[model samples]
Target: MADNLPPPSPSTSTHHDSTTKVTDMDIDSLVHCASYLTLHDISNMVLSCKFLNRVVYSDTIWRRLYREQWPEQEPYIISQTSCASAREAYLGRYTDLQRFKFVDPLVYDVHMGIGAKCSDLMFSNNSILFSQGPVIKILSIDKLLEGKTSIVSLNDHRARITCMRLFPLKETSLFRNKAQRNESVLVTSSSDHSIRLWWKGSCQRCFRGHNGPVTILSDKLLGDGTGKVFASGGEDSTVRLWSMSSGGKRGGQHALKATLYGHEKPLVLMSVVKHKASLLASVSKDSKVRVWDTTISSDRSSCCVGMTCVPGVPVGIKCHDSLLYIAAGSSFVAVDLRTMKTAFKTSTRNQPKLFSFDILPSKFLACTGGVGRAMLWDIRRSTGTGDADPMAELDGHVGPVTHLHMDSYKVVSGGREDPYVSIWDADTGNQTNILRSSSNLNLDGGGCGCCGMAADGFRIVTAAYNGEECVVNFRDFNNAVFYGAFSDNVTGSKFWCPSTSGHDHAGDESDV
Candidate 1:
């Protein structure tokens, strides 16, 4: 009996031992397995073999995974109608999030622990400029990426640095003396009531006239091909235009070209619109938006071309076509530059204090503020009665959203609490990745001061109120290094690249 039980047919044993190989699995089985893997893992699988790549990289699978990761975007992704369109949208969003399994440690940071509050920051010519107290610290972006300290600290102001604008001049026979053909000019304003001009890091000229802190800087090119000039608005309730004068036929320093006074309160923001001619738009603490003609830059030479009162103090203003998009308090107001009237006004949920709002090319406005969320509204679909709801909401930050920056593909936001710079897909409003800080740390009594897009298009540089500097590379979105103590407290910052061609202020006509 034992022998009979032990004896089994060779055919039966062979059949029982048969197993299905992985390569033999159907597309459904492969996709099911791929679903459990992270995007990076799936990418690795695709790269492992040609057949796997063809099988694993299907748009259907990607669409399913994208929807799973960002369900709120399902409506938009599904509305593409055509499979090709949906796939293209998915790839666009996916490529912006680029799959990465690991990230290198924070690449670079310099500790400029000068404990002054940083008011603003900017990036240009492979360098980053940030204002701390009355001094501006410049760090080379390329040097920072290599973990080296290449800084040029300029202490030209007596008080705090409030605003800065960089203008690229066209070097021709007429304006050859203004600057080197390749070099751009830097204009900075300070609480010291002075605006200084810098060419190649040296303070070339200083214009002192404002009785209070200068908070705004805007520049426009002269139509006569002479040179470009800039405008500044300050706490003294005046807008002053300055240009490199050709005094006595000799190249002169920056001189006061025009002074227009209209705002009853300190101006918070200003923009020079190139529409029809150079038109200047300024917002003051008095809740009034004033437009001026830059051509007639003297007192009484210009009347407010388009003026409107909003429900809250205007903090930010952007112009596109004939519309002026304004951010005031927690409400967003749209003004028709032609009619000089408020076309639409709407408040974010809970009336969160809106810090900054940018108008995107898609006719959508992206705004962030005291809330832990970023709000988006379609201006074309609004009801124009201060009752429009957000078309989509991006929620991730644990702290009040401080600043936002948007480009062709993504929207990046930073807050005071979260150690991550949240990045969202511009089209779908889906959070694709979080640029995590190396240290799980929060700023004490400080938050993100500002954020700006780099010339590389794939990088975003941000400054924190506690003097922290951050750089996020979209190609590797998961990791970022926080260079804390770069300055005491950064109030404002900008990113400028030498490789940046054309005038920096030219397309700024549409910047938010």
Candidate 2:
């Protein structure tokens, strides 16, 4: 009792002094607490007092922030360190991403007004080439930056443009001189029963074999972007393979390599898959699906390898690892390539009328159904099951969702009646963003002519009705980082390279 009473009285002066000296706390203690603060809070703290400046600039704090911002890139980002190199690395990465500013809506908007509606679009070498009626318009990305609507118009097709593809040049030609072999070459199909090859905005050759209007065109179908060999399907009930040997030096024109004839009705081209044997898959209005072998030798004519006759029109087709996934009527059927037999079928009784389908890298199928509904089916979980409920159903558009474009993180869908583009989280099926134009559109289906969008991890390009096109910036969408360099190898994007960086220094854009 005596020791306890004496202990407090002896240190009374020291304890009182310590309590009064709170304002003079050491820098380490304050900085460790600041570590829990956000970057903006720390930034304010730096300006609050000279003593806190050092604390805010600590390498440890910045390293934590960097890791928090780009967790997937930690293995590559946090490996290198510096005695005084925290903010420099982070700032460098930030500035390096300035070129990839498409995800930022505040940056800029490109508005172009043409007389006709845009049907399809493709990007190449910072230039946009799209179809409108019987014409194709070419606009440079630089021109868009300057708010210019002046475009190089290519008018040749006699009727409406059906589809177009900008295929890349051969590897040898591309590596030799990319500027010369730029995506200036285009293949277009039209309702005029002609497939024309264009070079530098001029028709180089005309393929005039299809008896009926050519509706679809495919490039790089054989897993090579050479733009040398391509296939076209038309209302003539046939599929034709066309090839331009390297530079087409033989006749300086495309040659008809093979013509596949099997489908009982007019062909509706879906997709081409190259496996042990190259296949050209197309569906018809009569619900007949045909897969033609394009890998036959020159001496042997190409023939139909497999066929599937359904009751309703097949909407779409996708191939992964030799397995064919078809969305027809109210079910998605998986066909084995080896046996050409039905491997499994999953029905969507609750959500019928499957129009278009896309298979995610994770084997999840995202299909657009009746009335602007996009449903996701986990094939691994739903395979061989009958009428399994979808994993998630996303509804946003006011009208029928006609087209869907998806990456690992997001899904961008457009509808027949809605003028807006809805972006959704692919995993959670939650609507993340809705982008619309300022112009008022009055029609049954505005921006419904084309619903698909193209993304380069930064910007999304989409075509709409009334001759309108929207380029949405997706830069900071959900704090997306340039993780394409560090994504998992199983996602089929292991070799994806960032195309929007402005600076590069030994692969580290940061000066530090």
Candidate 3:
């Protein structure tokens, strides 16, 4: 059999002797083999020759090859192969297929009071804040865990409350003559077309300006101490800035610092970059993302950076350092502010309706949509040629996922399903926990509609459609403790809950 076998090919003989010059072998063959190898294997093969490394690391070729094979049925190697023989020959050489694992669920739940639909939920420190109908309720998990019941209801708003934010109180020598830090306050916007400022036990003041419902409120303190201001975006297609002062007096009232007008459609979300307090970004239903310069004089309206526009009806917008991330109809796009251009765009494989997204401090984005799924994207590596694939898909909710919250290592998503809250490991995509609101606690004949996770990554708060709110803490997931609940009294529409922190009430916590 050895004698009958065909003679060794020239390519095979070329590598037999240490002194043999392999330069005469076909370069195309070597290039083809290198393309089929795994990134790890390719690195080893490149050590065999300088030419191999040069070809393998060529940005143009690898980028083109990567774009052609992502999120598809074909293996990257097979996609690069032009001939059936080459594909068949190389398929066996590369056997490592990326695998994803789903882990056991985290167990916890929150009981609802009076069975109502909850629209939004938020978590902070040891407390959870949620809204149902027009009312926002604050629950202290520490108090609940200790079996000491105490729920604070802030329902002073005349109309349905749409969004709530905890503003942080920063001490300034000018404001505090005795150098005492002021107590933090809660800033809330509502469909009633007003913004209310609340302190520990009272609704301090209400600012009226927007003609329509207030959608989002984002505030940041500017400068070290002298001047501090905040911004609020509304469905009225207007963004306003307010100056913080000592009292609720008209003299210290919210100053219409700057009016941002350009969104032809409703503005859905707003985020302020802490490093650049003058820089503010908003996403709107008009399929556009706008960046504004809020530092401009109040007399001069803020202008939008139309040049860096992201196409699509943006449902979510987040900014960190030099990057701007936007979520539109099943896709997310990242733009570099330095270049004022889109760097990468990736599909979420779902529609954009009734979805909410949150980006953790580590550049991980968690998005939930009507598909009843929450997906996490590792955006740090998504640049240059193509977008990064989703690190993991979280599937547990039976209804559309409405809201998502994530920290450095974990994710919490809420939807209208049996399990109201689903938690996951941010890196591994493993299901860390399933927090189910008690069926007996069902409100408005539906499950929790939207939810929020704590900044510390330990608590989840959810709201039902019928006007009910619930909070759950992950620390006691195995025992599945039910923290607390609140009832809404207005339109019976769902309300949003924001995590309760001294900063949330004071507007000092970094925006997500």
Higher-ranked by TM-score: 1 or 3: 1
**Mind giving the per-residue lDDT tens digits that candidate 1 earns over 1-512?**
77668666787674667678777888877877776777678768877887677667665677676677556445445433442544455554444333111122233334455465444555676777776678877777666666566878888789887787777644222336644665666778888888876666777677877788888787444334564467788988988776754232223333666778778998887766645446778888888878887666444545566677776667677776777778887887777888887777777767557766777735465554557787866667765665557777878676666667766566777665555566666666766455543222244334543333231244445543344444322122222111112112111110111122222222111111
TM-score of 2: 0.67
Give the least accurate 10-residue stretch of model 2, judged by summed lDDT: 486-495
Query: In model 1, where do residues sit more than 4 Å from their true spots?
Result: 1-106, 117-119, 171-182, 219-224, 245-254, 297-301, 437-456, 465-512
Query: Evaluated with lDDT, which candidate comes out highest?
Result: 2
Q: Is candidate 1 or candidate 3 better by lDDT?
A: 1
Residues 382-434, candidate 2: write the lDDT tens digits: 66836777777877666666667766766667665566666666666665555
**Residue 83 of candidate 1: its Cα lDDT?**
28
Which pairs clash in model 2? Answer: 102-473, 102-474, 103-473, 103-474, 103-475, 447-465
Cα deviation in Å at residue 143, candidate 1? 2.5
Q: What's the candidate order when arranged by decreasing lDDT?
A: 2, 1, 3
* lDDT over C-alpha atoms for residue 232 of model 2: 86
- What digit string (tens of lDDT, one per residue) describes model 3 on residues 98-175? 110111113235555554455455565566676666777777777777766567878877777777776555522123
